[model samples]
Target: MTVVAHPTDPTPARAPAATRTAGRIRGLDAARALAIFGMVTVHFGPFPVRGDDLASAAYRTPYGRASVLFAFVAGVGVALLSGDGSAPRVRSAGRRLVLRAALLFPLGVALQKLPTGVAVILQYYAIYFLIAAAALRLADRWLLALAGSLTLAGPMAIVLAQRAEPSWFDAGGNVGIRAPVALLRALVISGYYPVLSWAPVVLFGIWIGRRDLHAPGVHRRLVACGAG
Candidate 1:
């Protein structure tokens, strides 16, 4: 008796290994550049026109909102750079994170001394890198769960800390000078871009990465999400 090939049988030509990696998404790059430009404008305090109040709406309106956009875009960048769920690629990404963190830590500390009351986001970005490293290793479902829980817990943690006495975690005082520990705590608590609140955004990016962004449907989804 002769046996026939089954319709469900795997075909060598259709294997994933046969496909090449997708090209970089230019739209994402453009979005990132725009985010960076907005961040600069927000941080630099407008054009500082002569004899003006220097506190015009253009500068004030964008300051906090622009920084939040930058943080969200940074999360997308992290997800894009990790090549979605690929392990080997993410390991290399983790190394890059360490190098960037090492370089930015000192600069961040120095910037804190300035009168502007700004905490350089690179410091927080570095801490996010460390958290992402661990988060990336988990299953996608678990990653999302962890991200959601942390996002909710972050504000509550700060609230509880505030009520607990001493209040070292509060946004005032010498808390900025404590180096690594301070950096880690700020990333979780007082900072606007706290890791707990922001990690879910990154994990969302990771989930986005799992989809085929080059597809028209995916692009539309991205636009909708970005708009929201």
Candidate 2:
């Protein structure tokens, strides 16, 4: 990743430190940038591309994975923006997240009225933010444990719910303009990215955010587990 020299190079030559954030996690931002690029490809390019070419590879690769990365990274952002491991800071973070969600939910609903074919993820995104807000107070280990359990059990629960009563409640895609009853159903049970299935990724990312990324042990675990 070091294009100019080894990370531990002895050379004193370097760029200005103006861009460095004393406490920022650079890796999370890099991952987010890559996720955004992947999402762009998925949104603009045609699926299947009819060949074993770059387009087809892009189409197939980013379909589901990019959004997962995006959701996870957003959770990390929440943790970072909330500051560190403190109660007041966490509450402040929760307020910011809730307010942002409030603004985004209305924008998402308005966007739905447009003719764009995109299956907007904003409404589901707002819900994910809400979930992350509540989860930020949990200890790191508990967050990881919950995320792991959710990852294993969420799909099964979704399957059961769908079988038991499919779309029995559709709050018209969570658009407040669309009947109030349909809002809950569209956001939870019948949405394109159900929180039940996607929220774990966010939680897991939040768990990751709680780690000391500068530590060698944390980096090793992230590399090992992410590779796995």
Which model scores highest in lDDT? 2
List the lowest-lDDT window of 10 residues for candidate 2. 12-21
Which stretches in model 1 have alpha-carbon errors above 4 Å?
A: 1-21, 47-57, 169-184
TM-score winner among the candidates?
Answer: 2
lDDT of 2 by residue, 83-192 (tens): 65567878898999899899888788788767775677887888989998998887665677789898888878777877887765333343555565566766765667
Clash counts per candidate, in order, are 0, 4
> What digit string (tens of lDDT, one per residue) describes model 1 on residues 1-228?
111225763311111211113777777677677767767777675754545465565666566676666666666666566664467877887787777777876676567657777656666666766766665566555655776787688668777866774355665412455565765566676565666666666666554554455668667867897689
Please, what is the whole-model Cα lDDT of each candidate in the order they appear?
A: 0.61, 0.72
In model 2, the Cα lDDT at residue 17 comes to 24
- Residue pairs in candidate 1 whose N, alpha carbon or C atoms collide under 3 angstroms: none
> TM-score, each model?
0.73, 0.82
